[model samples]
Target chain A: MTFDVEIVRWHAVASWTWNAGDDVCGICRMPFDGCPPDGKYPGDDSPVVWGVCGHAFHLQCIQKWLQSQAQTDQRCPFCRRAWEFKAAAPSS
Target chain B: MIKLFSVKEKQKKDAAAINNPKQSAGELRMQKDMSELNLAKGTTISFPDGKDKLLHFEIFLKPEDGIYKAGTFHFDFQVPTSYPHEPPKIKCKTKVFHPNIDLDGNICLNILREDWKPVLSINSIIYGLQFLFLDPNPEDPLNKEAAEMLANNKAKFESQVQAAIQRGAYIGSNHFPPCR
Candidate 1:
C-alpha cells in the first residue's frame, strides 16, 4: 500500500489594514484600507496622512480639504488647528 | 477548508456596493453621513423626494426650550453633488418671525456659509439650526426688522413671534404662516 500525491505550486491569500486608530478617513469617510473617490487604488495610491493634531486622513482627501480653505487659515478639518503633516510614523 | 471562491465573490459584491460606478463621490459621502446622522432631540428628518433621493430632504425642528418652543418649523435641505465639500443649502420652509431666518426662508447660520468645512457632517448642520432657534442672534440677522425689534424691545419681539406662530399674522408687512 502506498500514497500517490505530489505537490506542485502553492497559492496563498492575505489581507491587511492600516494601523490608524480610526478606521475611516474623516474627509471622504472612506475606510483607510480603501482609496478615496479621486484615487484609483488603495494603500500606497491613497496613503494615510497624519496631522500634528493626531487625526489621520487619506493624503488626497486632506490635500483637497486644505485647498478648500483660505490660504491664511489652513487648519485641520477635525480639530480646527493649523494643518501640519506629522513627520514621524503614526503610533499604534 | 477555506471556501476561496465564495469568499472572493462576497468581496466583489461588497466592493461594488461601496464604490458604485453610477454614484458620484458626493453621493457616497452623503450616504455615509446620513447613515451616521444623530439628529437633535426635537428634530426629525424626512426625504420629500423619497428615500432614493438623499440629496433633497426636510428637517422638522421643534425647539423644546426657547422662544420658538411649541412651534413646529420646517426646513428644506438641498445637498449639492459637491456636498461635504460644500455645505448643504438650507432654507426655513415654514416662515416665522425669526431674526436669523428671513421672510424668504434665507437662513443666517455661519456654518451654512463661510464657516463650513468638509469635516462637518449633516448632524453638525442640524445642531447649528437647532441652536439658532434656541438663541436667535439679533446681531447677525437676515430679518432686519425682527432684529431691530428684538434688540429694542424684548416684550414686543415675543408678541411678534407669538402672533406669527399662532395666527399666521403679519408682522409689519410680511405675512407668516401659522406653524403651531
Candidate 2:
C-alpha cells in the first residue's frame, strides 16, 4: 500500500494495571488503578501489595489494616494466618 | 440537534456532588461488602433504616440443620466508622436458648472480638452467625448455665433448645421467645 500522507510527529500512548489477583482492594474497596481515600495518586502514591497468603491490597490500605490490630495478634486480613509481605515493594 | 441545558445541568449536579463529597472509607468498604455479601443458606438480611443506611442492619438466620433447626434468630448489626478495622457490634435481637448468646443479646464470637480482620466482610459475620446455630460452642460461651448444660448433657440441651423454639420456655431464670 502506498502512503497518502507523510508521518511527521507521532505520540505513543501506554496503559498499565496492577498484576494482582483481584481488581479492587479488599480493605479500601478501591480499584488498584485508583488511589485510596487518603491517597492522592494511584500508581505512584498508592501501590498494590501482596501477602504471603496470596491476597492483594493497596499498600496504604494494608498498612492501615495492620495498624488497627494489636502487634501480637497481627494477621492477614483475608486469612487468619500470620501476615507476611510477599516482597519488599513493587518497582513502580 | 444539540442540547444546550445538559451542560448547565451537569455542572449543577457536579457542584452538588462536590459539596456532598464522596463517602468515608469505611462506608465505601461497607457498601462493597454488602453488595458482595453471600448469605448462608436459610439466612437473610434486612435494613430497617432503608438501603441508604448501610452501617446498621439486621440478619435473620434460620438454620435448616443441627439443633437450632426451624428457628428464626434475629441479630442486629451496628457497624462502626472504623469497620473492617473494628468488627461490627452484633447483638442477638431474638432471645433464644443459646450458649454463645446471652439473655441480654450479647454474642460471644471470637471473630467479632479478637479475630476480626479487615479482610473479613459482612459475609463472614453472617456465616459465623449461621454456624453458631449449627454448632453452639460451649467451650467459649456467654451463657455459663447453657454452656454447662450443652457440655454435660447433650440430650438435655437438645430438648431445652427445642422447647425454647417450639414454645417460649424458661430454662433457668430467663424466658426465651418462641421463634420459628
Candidate 3:
C-alpha cells in the first residue's frame, strides 16, 4: 500500500573527450561519441586518432584538418608541434 | 546603455539558444571560451546571428593608443566545429590601411597560419589582432605598399593612417571603409 523508490543503479556515461578531459574534439568541436564532420557513426568507420601531443580526435576530423594543412606542412592542431600519429594498435 | 545579462537572464537566454534542439560539443566549448574571455581594454564582442550560432561572431577593437588610436575596427570570427585545434577564420570586416591586414581582409598573423596550436585560446587571437592595430608589422607584409611605407617612412605611414581615418581616402587605390 506504499510506493517506495529504491535507488540501486548509478553510473556515469563519459563521452570520449580529448586529452584535456573535455568531450569535444579540439579541432572540430564535435563530441567523439556522436557523428563526426563526415557524418559517420563512431566505430571502425570513424575511429578516434591520437596525436603525440596527447590530444585525441575523431579520425575523420584530424584527417580533414591534415588535408587542409598538407601544402603548408602537417602540424598538431593543439600544440602546433609536428603531428606524429601515435603507434598503431595491434589488430588481431 | 547596454547591460550584461545576469545568470538568471543568461539561463533564460540559453534556453532560447538551442536552435538545433541538441547542443553540440563545439557550442559548449565556445560558450566556455567566451565566458572566460579576458579581452584587452576597449575591445567588445558581439553575436551577429543571435546566441544560437555561437560559432560565428564579431569582435570590435578600438585601441586607445598607438597608430590605431581612436579608430574602431571590426573583425569577423568564424570558429569551426574543430575549434582550438583549428584556428578561427579571422577577417577584417572594417577595411583599414595596415601592413598585416590586406584589402580583402586577409590577415598575415603567424598564429592564424602555421603557428596555430590547440593550446592557443580565443583570447590569444584577440590580443594578436589588437597588436596588429597598435604596432603594424612591416616584416610580414600583406599590403606591400603599406608595409613599405611603415618600414621605410614612419612619418608618411602615420600621416596616411590619419588621413585615411577621417575622410574614407584611398591607400594605393584600395579604399578603406570609414568605421569611426
Among these predictions, the greatest lDDT belongs to: 1
Give the docking tier of candidate 3: incorrect
Write one digit per residue (lDDT tens) for candidate 1, span B124-174. Answer: 898898889888889977888999998999788888787778777888897
**Runs in model 2 lying further than 4 Å from the true structure:** A1-5, A52-54, A80-92, B1-18
lDDT of 3 by residue, B1-180 (tens): 134457768777878776546655457668768877998778899999997689999999998888778888989999977675578899998888888988888999988987776556788899888888888889969889999999999998887787777667777777765666
Q: Which ten residues in a row have the lowest lDDT in candidate 2 chain A?
A: A83-92
Give, for candidate 2 chain B, the lowest lDDT window spanning 10 residues: B1-10
Error of 1 at B47 (Å): 1.9
Number of clashes in model 3?
7
RMSD of every prediction:
8.1, 4.9, 9.0
Task: Kindly give the number of clashing pairs for every candidate.
Answer: 0, 0, 7
- TM-score for the A-chain in each candidate structure: 0.81, 0.84, 0.65
lDDT-wise, the better of 2 and 3 is: 2
Candidate 1 docking classification: medium
The segments of candidate 1 whose C-alpha lies over 4 angstroms from its true place after superposition are A1-14, B1-21
Chain B TM-score, structure 1:
0.85
The chain B TM-scores of all candidates, as shown, are 0.85, 0.87, 0.85
Candidate 3 backbone collisions, by pair: A27-B82, A27-B83, A28-B81, A28-B82, A29-B81, A77-B118, A78-B118
lDDT of 2: 0.85
Say which candidate scores most in DockQ. 2
Which structure is stronger by lDDT: 1 or 3? 1
> How many Å off is the CA of A53 in candidate 3?
6.5
